[model samples]
Structure formats: C-alpha cells, structure tokens
Target chain A: MTTVARADGSAPELLDRLAADRATGALSTRAGIFYLSAGHVVHVESPHSPDLGELLTRSGAVPPAGWWEAVERAGTRHRVGRHLVDSGRLTAGALELCQLGALFDAAYCALAHGGTVLRFRPGVTHWLGAVRPVPVATVLHESWRRRELLHRIWPDPAVDTAPLTRTGGTGPVALPPRRARTLALVDGVRTAAQIASASAHRTFHTLVELRRLAADGLVAPAPPPPAHPATGAGGAAWDEPDTALLRRLLDALEAL
Target chain B: MPGIDESLLETMRLPGARGALVADWISGLALGAVGEAPGGDAEATAAETAEFARLAVESGTLAPATPAVPATPGTGSPPPPPGSEPPVQDLILTTADAYHLLRFVSTPFDSTVFLYLWLDRTDGNLALARIRLAETADRLVLG
Candidate 1:
C-alpha cells in the first residue's frame, strides 16, 4: 500500500480521513470551524460568514424573539433546530434549507481561508446540533467549486477581501435589482462579509455580487491596507495576523 | 412536513421515477439524494442541474417583466412580490430515455433549493410527476 502522505494534512485531507474512519468532532481551521457527526459535517462556522441564527432571523424565517427563545431552551441540548420546528416557528424543511445555506456559505469561506493550523477536537459536536448532516466530500467539493466560480466571474480576489466603494462615473449601470442593492451598500469601509451581515444576506451571495460588480467596474477597492503590517509606531505590539485583514493588501495597488 | 429523506422517498414513489435529489441552486450541493443520478454521480448531477436552474431563473430576458410603478390595472400580471416565490415555479427537461423535473421550493430564506426528479420516459407521466414534485417541494423538510 502506498504511504498516505496527505492524510489529515490539509483541511480537505483531514476531512477525507475522518470520513473514512467515520469520526465525529469539530475541525477548527483558521478560516472557520466545522462540526462533524459520525463523519458527516453537521455544521460549519466562518468568521467571515453569518451564522445560522443570523441567516434565519434576517431572512425572516423565524422572528428574533422566537429564535432566542429556542436557543435558551434547547441550544444547550443541541436541539435548537428541533426546538424551532417543534414550536411551529417554522417547518422542518425550511430550517434544513436555511441550515444548509448557512453551512455551505460559511464552509466556502472557511475552506478558502486555507490556513495551516487545522485542529480537530474529537466528540465535540456543535450546540446547534446536526440539523442535516452533509457528507464531508460534498462540503469540500462545493467550496472548491465556489472558489472556481468566483475566480471565473472576476479573477480578482481583492473585491472579496477589500473594503469597497462605488464607481464615481455617472454612466447608468444596468444591473439586476439584487446586484444593484448590494452595490449600494458599498461605502469604502465594509468588506464583502460586513456588507453581507449588515444587510442580513448570505455572505457567499454577497461575494458573488461583489465579484460581478468588480467585473463591471461598478465597485473598486477603497485603498490598499498596509502590506507588511508589522511594528506599530507607538510600541512593539504584535497583532494576530487576521487572514481577512492581511488579505486586504494582497491586491493593493501602489499608493499614488 | 416531510424531512429531506422522506421527501425523496415520496418522490421515488412516482410511477416512473428513477431517482430524486434536493440541491441548492446557489451552491450546487446535493442536500439529499436517492437512487441513480443521470451522471451516475449525485454531486455532479446536482451542480449541473443547478447551473441549468440558474440560467433559467436569473436570465433577464426570460424573467417576468417588472410592473411600472404607477397603477395600471389593465395590464399583465404584476411581478412576483419581492422575497416571495420565484417567478418561475418549476422547469421540465425531456431527454431521449427519461424526463427531468426541477421544482423550486419557497422557504423563509433565499429559497435557493429545488427538487430534481428523474423519471423513465416510457412509464413516467409528466403531468403526474410535475404535480407530485410541486407538492413534495411544498412540504419537504430540511433539518
């Protein structure tokens, strides 16, 4: 048998290994956190993407009061999803759809993070519980596909990570209403994820819209963040290398 | 409300259904699937079908026209209410050997999920499959 060089090496490799062993636990990556149950990815959370509750309340799936109540009553037992459904706040299918959406949305960013520090804590399931267990393969494969799609739509990754501003040109830009609305939210301070949360929209969808905006010159990076964010002027305070923050300078242009 | 697996099973009960799947149109991930996929790979099929659905749903030329702001009673149907059902409810594709039906499900969120059913052409009743798929979509549970 050939040596398994890649097993548990990268996020994808580790997930594959876990699936093979039917392992259950949480995989903590710099990009995001994934909770697996018996080899199935029950939930995934990314710092750059809205969580299930955000998606649920923002989408008007369940009222905010009801959502908090469910969490208070059932979150500790990992039955928040079930609680919401049983309480008739929403149907089981609706919760599943929303949960899947949130999972895939965050999973894409989580994997896109692609950092080296990947850790898995065995037997630690998410308090949200396994609303619907997605196969690990499906999660990884979709993340790759989304990365490719975003690249193809607009090869620039800056629009995804950088703060954005609208183009000053007065030319009428004919765009679908959805993209137009997302564009209006750009104020040279909010990154795609910030805009997504502020608008209560899916972070991935917001990214797609931003990419499209960049492709059409409707949006542009506000300004390049410092490339080498080292050595503070006041004192030597080493800050955490926030992936999203560091990435803001990846495509930064030379200061004019 | 039938959960995803139960919903798939319900669709499979159709007379000519060869397979069934629930996929997110936006992410192209197969949420739940049962039986053989047209591509022999459920994930692959889900992605391809999602592409097909996006083309139909997002195309400006094919979507229903937005009604003018001012009230005009004697005119075509008003555009679907924002955040309501998608303009196009379902789509059907006929192949040489089988029939494919995609029914969009409305949810509290983006409503990006759809039900895909593959039915044998010879034995499948297109009308029946369409109705059942729509019903299944209405009640298919997720969590």
Candidate 2:
C-alpha cells in the first residue's frame, strides 16, 4: 500500500503505477475521482466537471460574470451544483443536466487519455457517487451523442476552433445549409471579430462549430513546408549557345 | 412531480408509440421503458446512439466546413487558450419509422441523467411528441 500526500500528487502517480501494475482501483484527485478495472478506466467525476454553469449562464438562470467566483467557492466547498441551485444561479433541472454533462465530460476525457491509471477501492467514498471513472468505450459513446446533438443544431463542423473566416473571392458562393449558415457568417476576412460579433447569440456556438469542422476533417491549418533551394536546368552551368541556336532556327523558319 | 414510471406511461399514451424508455446515458441503463423491445437491445441501442453524437462532434459534421480566415499580415488571431470548455452536446436520432429523442436532465447532485424516448413513425407526430417529451421532462424526479 503506497500512501501519498495531496490528492493531486497521488492521483496521477497512482494512475501511472496502476497502469504499470495492471491493477484496478479507484484513483481520487482534487479534480475528481475515477474507477479503473483490469487496466481500463470505467468512470470519472471532477469538481468543476460538465456544463451546468454554462447552461445556466446561457439559459439566463445565472449571471455569466459570477461563474468564476462561484467556481472558486466550489473549490473549497466541492459542491458546485448545490451552490448554483442554492444561490439561484440555475434551476434544479438545469443544475442536474449540467452536473450530468460534467460527469460525462470528465469520464470521456479520462478514457480518451487511456491506459490503466485507474482502480476501485472497496471502502473509499468520493462525492457524486463516482466509484471510478468510466471505460473509454462508454465515454466515447456519450461524447459522440453530444456531438450529434450539436450537429443537428448547426450542421457545419468548420467553426470548432479556428476563428470564423468570412471573406469571399470574386464569385457568388451559395451559402451552406440553413443550420450551417446560422452558425457561420461570411465576413470579408475578420475571423475572431466575426465570432465575437456573433457571440451574442451564444458564446460557445461558433467555438463548437469550429471544433466540429476540425473533427470532420473538412478544415485544417495548412502546414508550412521546409525551406529548400530551387532546383532546375536554369543554373549558372546552362549553355549560352542554346539561345543563339534557337534564334537562328527561328530566323530560318521565318525565311522559309 | 411525476415519477419515472408515470412518465414512461404518459409517453406510451402518444399515438403510434412503438416503444419508450427512460435511459441514463451516462450508464446506458434503462431506468423505465414501455412498448416493443428495440431490435438491437436497450444497452446496445443507447451505446450506439451515444457514439453517434461523439463522432459527429469529433468529425465536425455539426458545423460548416470552412478554414478559419487568417488575420492581417501584421496580426494573428489569438489561439484558443488552454483550459477552455470543449463545445459538445447530447444527441437526438430520428428515423423514417421512429423518432428517438435523448434529453439531459440536471440533478441536484453531480449526476447527469438522460431520458431517451422512442416513438413509432407511422402513428406519431414528431413535432407534437417532442413538445410533449420536453413537458414531461420538466416534471421528472431523478433518483
């Protein structure tokens, strides 16, 4: 039994050691707790997990400006959902969904960064009924469902990360589908500004679209090529007689 | 507030209701269900539906397909800083014969549960069913 100080320090190390040992147990960290069995993560929870705050903020249940302070308070109390509800940051229903989203997100992140670093402890109790983090398969499935929902709301996937680029060339470009057009606007060349301008509709809408585009392989940053010298027959060693001969041939052909 | 069983029963009352189930997406567990068994099985169906959502977001089919415009020669758009929230959401699947809806409900605790509803295509009005489901969700109490 290896005892360590601080949840942060012990959590990551325990995950690594568990992976090395191929053991199964619950690993608890300041961020959250997750379950692992047979070198596979099965569940996760984080202090600041999911989209409850965002949902509340977006739905007008909570003031966006007060989110950070609430999160800070949650750090000490470790009960963000309750805090938000008690403070009237969000209604009970919204709080539940947000907490669910956070739980799903944390579990997804852990599984995506896979390889046995989680385990289950028979006697340990973590807040939020998190016995351990969920398996990668489970996390992945949930994440996929969430992505699909976003897609239905806004069909295009290009606006997920890179700023929205709105410039067009000389021709009239037919707009994408209705859902896509609503999420993306064609500004002349201002990407971030366009997104910021549209942020009033929803702060994360543009961002989510960008992320989806990137995920779909529809858009990507063009990588710069390595520097290399030009190579052709036009080097200094080229014969000067070639031009003279060509001129003579042309003159002869014209005389004919 | 309506209990889980009552909600499932209410869902069954909808016209052309082939089947209905209240699922916890996080665990893929069927809390309550009514009607015909889904062809593939409940757990498998839930898992597949969830996977569809994740793939859509990861692949970017949810948004437009255009490159981010580069900033002016002298300026560059700031990188999305680290520790930002990832943009994603729960999913709904519709078929020619049935309408499937999954909604995430927030609980007082940190648990996120979803209600999955399956409606028969031939006899159900998709629009009306969605509205009903949303209303039903309002009164549900998660355990």
Highest TM-score: which candidate? 1
Candidate 2 on A1-256: residue-level lDDT in tens?
5443233333445655555666555675444566555655544554333334544464444577766666667645545545655666555444444444445655433433332433336333322222223444544455555556555644433333223333224454343332244335533232422443343222233334444443333323222123445466433322322343344357559979
Alpha carbon lDDT at B45, candidate 1:
93
Candidate 1: stretches off by over 4 Å: A1-9, A224-256, B65-85, B141-143
lDDT of each: 0.78, 0.47
Q: Residue A115 in model 1: shift from native, Å?
A: 2.8
B18: Cα error in model 2, Å: 5.4
lDDT tens string, model 1, A1-256?
2222222467888888888989888788889988889899999999999998998788777789999999999989999988988888877777787888889998888888674435678878777877888888878878888999888887777677777888658877666656777888999788899999987878888988898887776776765445665456622221322342344345444422
Model 2, B31-136: lDDT tens digits are 4567665684776666555445335433444532342433423211222222121222234577777777665443333333455677777888776776666566
Which run of 10 residues does model 2 chain A get worst, by summed lDDT?
A216-225
Interface RMSD of each: 3.2, 9.5
C-alpha RMSD for every candidate: 6.7, 15.9
For all candidates, state DockQ relative to the true structure.
0.40, 0.08
List candidate 2 segments past 4 Å from native. A5-61, A64-78, A86-88, A113-137, A140-218, A225-256, B1-18, B21-37, B43-116, B119-131, B137-143
lDDT value, residue B135 of candidate 2: 61
